[model samples]
Target: MIDFFNNITNSLIFNNFFLVLSGLDNTILLLLISLPIGFILALLFALGRVSKIIILSKVIAGYIFIIRGTPLLVQIYLIYFGLGSVKFIRESFLWYALKEPFWCGVIALTINTVAYGAEIFRGGIQSIEKSQVESGLSLGFTKFLLLRKIILPIAIRKVLPSYGNELILMVKATSLVSLTTYMEMTGIARKIMAKTFAPIEAFIAAGILYLFLNFLMVQFVKYLEWKYNPHLRLNN
Candidate 1:
């Protein structure tokens, strides 16, 4: 209706629009900071899972299990309030880092994503043919070299689509940081809605921004997949 359109237009006036955009940038900053760190940790865990050491394997498995089984919001709260509640933590060297809501959210999201990403990567590594490992090992490839030259690259290619989904999930998950009073896109939208008494318009703007971000991310992932899978491109 005309009234709805007018409300949206009015709500998105320059000042309000910029506030919403700032929130989205916060969301993006959270994702950008968390993801690479998470991926590195995940790759290490995945390697541990496939390692021959039973103790190391079990420890990594337990870590993945615990993180994957819990709700992310609960993890966020636990890191933000629960840890911060501890007197010892408050006095520790880590206190400086744990004291901030943004860092707490980053820690939670990174841990959660690492759990999922490790599994995806583990599966991809396992999917590689046994013969390839044999071939690499026979060719004087050290275990480290074999993994770097053979396993990781192939596994990465195999996991790209799944990892892409995980990336998008992390982007959306950043919205939950708002519960900690770290005003990302969703938090800003809520504030605007409260002030203007226009929940629908505020939410719609936030949703569109999220959709746009996810769209660009999805396309980028697809391009990566295509770039890596040359044989598929050749077949096509």
Candidate 2:
């Protein structure tokens, strides 16, 4: 057992495996960038889902259906390879962006997250009481004002726990980006393991890094829940 600990430490430190794991900026960046962008688009999709416009709602529903039904790995591959394979795409101005693995990963992650996020947000928005809307209007609130103030706040509080889970899933999903040759945490781990022949130590260190990041995210979500649910906090 002591020898195993020594080997793990040696693999991490002397082999520079720890440095590779610690410097996971791209993985963290993918999560940070994709989360906000995906959520913003999801808010629009959610609004469309609940809106009076039949076409808008149906279109958003179809989008969510297609995205949610498909495998994320396939989605990433299609965006990275399938799109990149098109001659028009290669000739078009968009090629510059599409050719890069990082952008492809981001696009895939964003679209995937948006589908799940839209459903989560829609459920939360629909869960809001009609009386709440009536109350907001009675207080002279405009549609935008109602959404910005009462409706959005309450819906966010309702959906936060679910959203937090999505965020964690996204973090794990980033491991797939390694296939595109973007050296995120998992990619770095694979490379280290390949060179050092220490699969257990290398992968375990990588897992620990993910666990640590998710731990921070969980705490942050708990803080958001407590902060947003003031009535609950007050009652407690």
Candidate 3:
């Protein structure tokens, strides 16, 4: 028990908490950069998938299919390693971004996330009752009015829970970038383990940090759910 407690303290306190700080910052950067862009692109793709334009729908569908069908690690490698291999790509200005593992990881994460997010959002859009849509039309609601008032509100509410889960998944998924030599939480943990030769303590510390971050996210989502649903607020 004493040894376990000592190891935990040493892990957190080493070099004035370098491991914790570096890992936390990099992870947050990845989340902030990727999730917002991913959300916007996902929403656009979702809207495209639902729209009547068959060609747009099919193109987005195919892109989503490829992303969803492949593993994220493969996508990361393709971005970081594969892209830089092409002679034209190597000579091009875009190589500046592609050659850096961090940006490559961001690109891969954003692309991978948008696929699942698109599907989640598409489901939300489809969740609106057909009769409600008809009623809106009967009421002479303009297409703009119908979307702004009915579709947008209900669809967003429906999408929140699933979207929150995706956020949590993204947090975990950031660990994969460690393989690209980007020093996020797992990468930091690996470094600590290498130095201390204590894999268990280092990994446990990283896991605990992940749990804490996810807990905050979960609570924030719960708060959003409570705010969105007045009925739940009333029950309290």
lDDT of 1: 0.91
Model 1 Cα shift for residue 45 (angstroms): 0.3
Q: Compose the digit string of candidate 1's lDDT tens values, residues 70-121.
A: 8999999999999999999999998998988899989999999999999999
lDDT of 3 by residue, 1-236 (tens): 99997887665445424565568989999999999999999988898999999999999999999999999999999998888889999999999899888999899999999999999999999989999999999999999899889887788788999999999999999999999999998998888888978777778778888998999989988988888777657666
True-vs-predicted CA distance for residue 26, candidate 3, Å: 0.5
User: Once model 2 is optimally superposed onto the true structure by TM-score, how far is the C-alpha of residue 34 displaced, in angstroms?
Assistant: 0.8
Please write out the lDDT profile of model 2 over residues 1-236, one tens digit for every residue: 99988887765544555656554788988888888999999998899999999999999999999999998999999999999989999999989989999999999999999999999999999999999999999999998999999888989899999999998999999999888888898888888879878788788778888898899989999999998888887666
| Candidate 3 accuracy as lDDT | 0.89
Collision count of model 3: 0
Model 2: pairs clashing at backbone N, Cα or C within 3 Å: none
Task: Give the candidates in order of lDDT, highest first.
Answer: 1, 2, 3
Best by lDDT: 1
Between candidates 1 and 3, name the one with more favorable TM-score.
1
